[model samples]
Structures are given as C-alpha cells and as structure tokens.
Target: MVASTGHEPCELGPIDYLVIELPQGTTTLTEQMTDQIIRSVSDRTLRILELLIVERDGAGDLTVTEFEELTDRGLRGLDASLVEILAGEDVHNLASAIAPGRCAVVIVWEYLTATSFTAAVRASGATLVAQGRIPAQAIAATLRGDDEDA
Candidate 1:
C-alpha cells in the first residue's frame, strides 16, 4: 500500500462522499483526484532527478584527473558534456514551485553523496558488496517494527 503523508485525509465510505480539506476550501471528488495525480507526478519527477544525478556522478565526469586516480578507472570515452545535459533535464522549473525545500534538487544532492561513497569503495578495490545483504540489512534495521530489536 502507498503511504500518504497525512496532508490529506482519506475516506473509506462512498466515493462521492469523499471530501478533501484544502487551503482554498473543501475539495470535491474531481479536485481530490486531480490533487492525487499532481502529487504522483511530482514524486515521479523527484525519482527521475535522483536517478539522473546518480548517472552523472557515477559516469565520472564531474571530477578531474584526481577523481580518475582515486577511482582507479580511466574515462577514455566518457563525455562530460553529455552527462551535464542529462543531469540538467532531470530537474524542472515546477520543482521549485511545488517542493521548494524538499525538491528534485535535494534528491540530486543526496544521490551525489551516495555516488561518491560508492566510488570511493570501488576505488579501494574493497570487497564490499555494492548491493544485496548490506543494504538490505541496513534497511531492515531502519524499518524494523517497534517490537523488533534494532
């Protein structure tokens, strides 16, 4: 089930009876549906922004020779300009209007941090598992029920 942020109330009764409390006024069924659609699209755009940042930072274009040396990888055919363009399209002007503080820009920033960590690990030739158990364990620890041990 999708988790709502509780900014809107949900009803379990007849669809026609559903009402949404908005800043303007109580919203009818059509307005509520429209709000839901808009929120969904915004969330999707943020996810895309996160992905683009990951791709841009992971492709080894933002850094220079030090970055290449640190990663122990050569960027022989990598196109820095193309990475910049891809990253640019990930964010839209609407992001600032809809989610100024926690918007697509924040997502991109977080992704860049994560990408840097991954690159450092890769450069060290450390036998750290990129995915699978470690991340799963961390998430499980974070999301464990109140009754479960940490």
Candidate 2:
C-alpha cells in the first residue's frame, strides 16, 4: 500500500504506513498527538539519561548544555515540549550539581520517528494507506513485551 506524496519516494522499509486523510473541516488532533508523542519520547529520553548517569563514572556533575552537546545526535525535530523538558531548570541544575570530579554522560539510542510526522499527517485531514519499514512482527513483540527476535 504505497500512497504517493507526489514528491520524492519515501522509503519506509517494511512497515505499513497509513496516510489517513482528514475530511474537510475535520477536527485535528495534531496538538494533542504532538503533546502525547513528545511527552512519551521525553520520558524515555530522561530514563536513558538517568541510566547513562548511573553507568558512567563521575557523570553526575555535568551541565545541561554539556549533556545536550553529548546527546545531540537525533534531536533534530523534537517539539517544544521535549526541548522544554530537556532544558528545564531541574534538569539543568541537576547536571550542574554533579560532584566536582564527575562528568555527566548520556548515551542515546536512535530515534526511529520524527516528532511531527504523525501529527502533521493527522492535521492534514487526509487518510491513505502507505508502506512503512516497521515490521508487524516487531510491533507484535513490542506489544507482548517479548524480544523482537522471539
């Protein structure tokens, strides 16, 4: 199910991408969806940060800016919510308060999706089926809390 964007071809791998078209004058959930996705991704990112702090030696004392620089790989399209959360006072202060000898370290995994991709499509008020790279088996495993290789 390939839905043409009428632009360059988007290679979505094997996952089925649904391009839902919103009807004329249809109510959009773009803001709501963006909020939800941002929150979820931010929370996950925070968790990863916490884990990194725990794993690295003397990593509890880095500044927020330092952490941002270190983890700046895949945050290209993060929405404002995520940026705010990352730059919040608490996070900044925490990074700054690390022990004198310790440096803050954060390990980030690859983010597979963009913050605005789904929201913008939803806002466009259109529905169409498109092909993606997300494997159905992987999605099922995720839903079941099983390993993807299982």
Q: Tell me the deviation in Å of residue 138 in model 2.
A: 32
| TM-score for each candidate, following the candidate numbering | 0.20, 0.21
lDDT by residue (31-126, candidate 2, tens digit) is 454355346557643212221231112444333333233243344344322212233454444444344444343323223354245445655776
Candidate 1 off by > 4 Å? 1-110, 130-145, 148-150
Clash number by candidate, in order:
0, 20
The top-ranked prediction according to TM-score is 2
- Model 1 C-alpha lDDT per residue in residues 118-149, reported as the tens digit of each score: 55555677644434323445567768763353
Give the Cα-based TM-score of candidate 2 against the true structure. Answer: 0.21
